[model samples]
Each structure stands twice: as C-alpha cells, then as structure tokens.
Target: MRTAALLGAILLIILGLAQGDSDALGDDQPMFDVRKVEIAGELKYSDPNALQQYYDQLLGSGLFDDSMGNLTNFVTRPPWIESAKVRRVWPHTIRVSVVEHRPLAYWNAGQIITAEGQIITPRRLPDLPLTKLMGPRDTESVVLDQFSLISQMLSTSSLRVAKLELEDRGAWNIQFSNGIRVALGRTDILDRLGRFVAVYKSDLSGRIERISSVDARYPHGVAVKWKLQE
Candidate 1:
C-alpha cells in the first residue's frame, strides 16, 4: 500500500510541471494589449482619428518588432507628428501618445505660396494670427526673406506690419496697423525707408489725421497722401 501511494504522489508532481510549462508558453505569445495612452503638447490642430489611423497602419505592417529602435523610428518620421509612444495594456487596445505640429500663418494660395512653391491650401491654415505675406507663386522664399527684413525694420521703429505683398515686378507694398500703404521699390529699400522714418519723426508724427499712402520709390524723398474725410 505504501509503495502504491508513493508512485501516485510522483505522478501527480509530473502532471503539475507539464501544466505549468503549457501556461508559460501561452504567456509568451504576443497579444494585442494596450492599457493607457497619453498625448501632450499643441494638439489643437491635430485630429485624433487621423493619428490613430496612422498608428493602426503601422502596427498592421508588422514593422514594430517589440524593440525600442524600431518603435522610435516609427513615430518620428512624419513632419507634423513631433513624437509618439505606444504601450501595451491588457487585451487588445494599444495606448498611443502623440505630439502635434504648429503653424505660423495662413498661406493664401492666391497671394502667397509655401517654400516648395506649392499653393498654400486653406487646410494648412495656422491657428496663430500672423502677418499676411503675399508674393508670386514661385517667389515665396524671396518674399518671405524680404518680409523678415521689413519686420525687423518695423520693429526698430515701433511699427507693426499688417500685410506685406510683393508685386509681380518685384516691388514691395506694405500696410500698417494705421491703415497706410507703403510702396517700397525693389532697390534701395533701406535708404528710402529710412527717409520715410525721418519724415515721420520730424514732420508728421502726430499732426496728420490719416495717411492714405506713402510712395518711397523716388530718389530724393517720400510722397504722402492724406486720407479723405468720411
């Protein structure tokens, strides 16, 4: 009876070990599991659904091999997406965190184009209110570069530029907050602009009620137009 009882106990231990091994193998398999997803930083313009769709496509491609390097590359490729992190939670939901892009201005296709000469679409409009910059379609970079110089000049003079447009012939037309247009010719921009500033400071600082426009293209001085009474 003792011998039979000992044999029974040994058999039970072997069976238990086999069951444990099977459970471990099951745990080793990759299961669709995500617990928590966190997103941060400038998400006002980003669509959550679009980001999720991108994530789904990547995961479906089987590119993420549960490795850190592959996962890092997957998240940072897009220009708009700043960063992304994915985590597995429990059963079948992947938690994804993402950072979005910020736009500087609304590039109007009719007036201004992007650096790539692609017509700036309304969909790419930025939330931030920036100065409108207009130029020929293929000359956006040149116009943008000039605008930066004009902006600096205005800053020094404590003036604000509402709109800056580049003419087809390469001249510049700028508007100020006070509803005045400044015609700056293609050449000698800085010198002509300096003359206008000197006139504003010495002659027309506060005496003029309104200024319709200022023509700064002439060699000797600037011609000012007074606003008509309403």
Candidate 2:
C-alpha cells in the first residue's frame, strides 16, 4: 500500500508540472494582432499620414516583434517628436500618442518656413502671433543658431518680440510688441542688448508711454524714439 501511494504521488506531481508548463506557454504567446492605430496630441504641425508612414515602416521591418524587446525606443526619439507613447489594445488595434514641436518663431523665410526650411503650416489657418525672423534665403542655418541668444534676451523683460530681421549685411533689427523697433547693428549684439537692459531699467521703466524705435548700434549709447500721437 505504501509503495502504491508513493507512485501515485509522483504521477500527480508530473501532471502538475506539465499543466504549469502549458499555462506558461499560453501566457508567452503573442497577445494582439495590431491593426488600427490612433494618434493624439499632434497639434497643428504634425502630418497624420507622415506619422502613419513612419509607423508602418517600423511594423513592416519586424521591429515590433517581442523577441526584439521594446519597440517604442525608436519612435519616441525622433527630432520632430517632442514626446510619444505606444499602447497595444485589443487583438486588432494599436494607439500612438504624440506631442509635436511647434515653432516659437520663424527664421530666414518670413513666417512661412521653419528654421530647418520645412514650410510651417498650422492646422488652423490664421496669422501667427509669434515673432518672425528673416535672413538671407541661404543663411537660415546661421540665423537658427542665433535664435537661442535672441530668445534669452527677450525672456528677461516684458518686451515681447513681433519680428526679428537679420540683413545679409549682418545688421540685426527687432520689432517689439508696443510698435517699437530696435536696431542693434552688426557687431557685439550681446553687449548692445546688455546696454539696452541697463537703459530700460534706469530710464524707461514705468515712465515711457510708447517708444517708436531704439538704436543700439552706437557704442556706449542707445537712441530711443517715442511714438508720436496721430
């Protein structure tokens, strides 16, 4: 009787092991058949078809296979994509959430072209309230490089920019929110802007009504033009 009981116990254990293995195999099988894809947070700049094309490339390349690890790493790091998330839902669908980068200002080609020369198009067609920058058609890259400095200068005060133009002669001009224009000449732009900050802090704070223009091209001085009443 004892021998029979031990043999029966061994048989039960083997059966349990087989059942566990079967369950594990089932869990490891691929879950969903990815079909429809949804994208969100594209804003005004992202092209739905272009984004879909990118995903199709990934899927067709077998990059989505589980044996290859997470497929999201490739999708989220693209230059134009600010952020992205991928989700698999149901057996026939996938969803991709994307946040696209919007241009804060245009460089070189009016408000029509991005800093990279990609034409800027918003979903809603209306005039952009952001600053515009223009430079030589071929010099857009240099202008883009200088955008960081220009952006930093604008951030220090209430002076908002409507447009900033860089002439082919290297001259720089900025139009402000209050109908004021500023000319910072071609040399030592950082130093010239610094001087303007000092003057704004001392002479123009809370006292001036409207300034038509300021010339910071001159060394050791900045010229101001007050707007005349019409």
Candidate 3:
C-alpha cells in the first residue's frame, strides 16, 4: 500500500509538470507560426495545386492564430467540399480533414447535383459517365426527386438511364443506355415506364438496335419507332 501510494503521488507530480508545460504553450499563452500543415481526405475533384497555394497563403497569415474559423471557412468555400474540420498539433502543425459532396447526376450541362439536390459547378467535370438530369433552375428538387424514383425503378432492369429531361410543359422523357428514347408525357411517368418495361422484358431489349424511340403517352399501349435497317 505504501509503494502504491508513493507511485500515485509521483504520477500526480509528473502530470502537474506536464500540465505546466502545456499551460506555457497552450493556445492563449503564445501564438506560434504554422510550420507544417497536413490535409487528410479523399479528394479527387478539388485541385491539389490550388489547395497547396491556399494553405501556403493561410499559414503565412499571422492572423491565423488558434481559431479554426479561418481554415474552416476557406476549405468549405470550395464547391466540392461539403465540410471540413481543423485541429492543431500543439506547436507548429495544423491538420485539416474534409468531407466531399457526392455527385449523384449531372444537371443542366456543366453542373453536377448532389443526391440532396445541392448544385455544384466545379471547374472541371469529373470523367465519370453520370446520367444527365435537366429541368428549370427552380425545379431542382422536383426533378431530382423524380430522377431518384426513376433510377430506383430502372435499377431492377439490366439497363440504366443515360439522360432524363423535364420540359417546361411538364412533359418527361428518358433515354436509356441503349440509346432508345421514351416520351412519358405529363403524368403517370413511372406507370408509363412500367408499361414500356413490360414490352422491353418481353420484346424490346433483345431488339434494342432496331428501336429508335418509344412514345408512352397512350393509356393502354406504347408506340415504338424502329431504326432504318441497311
């Protein structure tokens, strides 16, 4: 018991000395210059050169003392970054971790939209062959919601959508990966697609090369246009 008590007392004394050292160099005691900075995250679309330059200028700023406000603001402002966390490695090093936006589909032409309907226009589009979704700027949520529903419905098929468009007149159209276009008109879009799918499972998919377009505006049947065979 005596030895244990002595060891406990020594540990407490050591901890106190360490705490004093921390107090001498803590955030409030003295502001230190950033000598090293590490960025940790799976970043693909964000430019690494721009990131390096950004950090260089930021660390050079004497005003970047201990507050994470500057770093967080700077990192999150980039279109690809969803959120960022900043931490100090005690003396001269700062670490930044970031979460990126997941691009669900391409919007308009150059813009990409997240699954949550947030639009981002990166400097360069990713090389991914994403499905395109188009609609008025005000109808992003509506269009995105419909795209999710349509994509989920098509997931059961052997094929996938290449593009989806919603015109000002509320007409909907989808182009499948096999380059077959389907006009869904205004209402009952998925129901129309289901009708078309029945034909596809029974007939069309095997003859995809001969099919150019499908008009599903009929309540009971769909119209198919065949390609000219040479």
lDDT of each: 0.63, 0.66, 0.83
Better of 1 and 3 by TM-score: 3
Provide the lowest-lDDT 10-residue window in model 1.
29-38
Could you give candidate 2's per-residue lDDT for residues 42-114 as a string of tens digits? 4565566767776765442221464322656656554456667777654345667877666656554434554
Looking at model 1, the pairs that clash are 33-89, 34-89, 35-89
Per-structure clash totals for the candidates? 3, 0, 0
**Deviating ranges (above 4 Å) for candidate 3:** 1-31, 63-66
Candidates 2 and 3 compared: the better one by lDDT is 3
Candidate order (TM-score):
3, 1, 2
TM-score of each: 0.63, 0.54, 0.80
List model 1 lDDT by residue over 80-180, tens digit each: 56567765543344455666544443344422243343343433444555667777666667766776787777676756777888888878888776666
Q: Residue 133: error of model 2 in Å? A: 2.0
Local lDDT at 168 for model 2: 81
13-57 in candidate 3: lDDT tens per residue?
Answer: 867765766744555433445667788899878887777667666
User: Candidate 1's error at 98, in angstroms?
Assistant: 4.1
- Candidate 3 — worst ten consecutive residues by lDDT sum? 23-32
TM-score of model 2 relative to the true fold?
A: 0.54
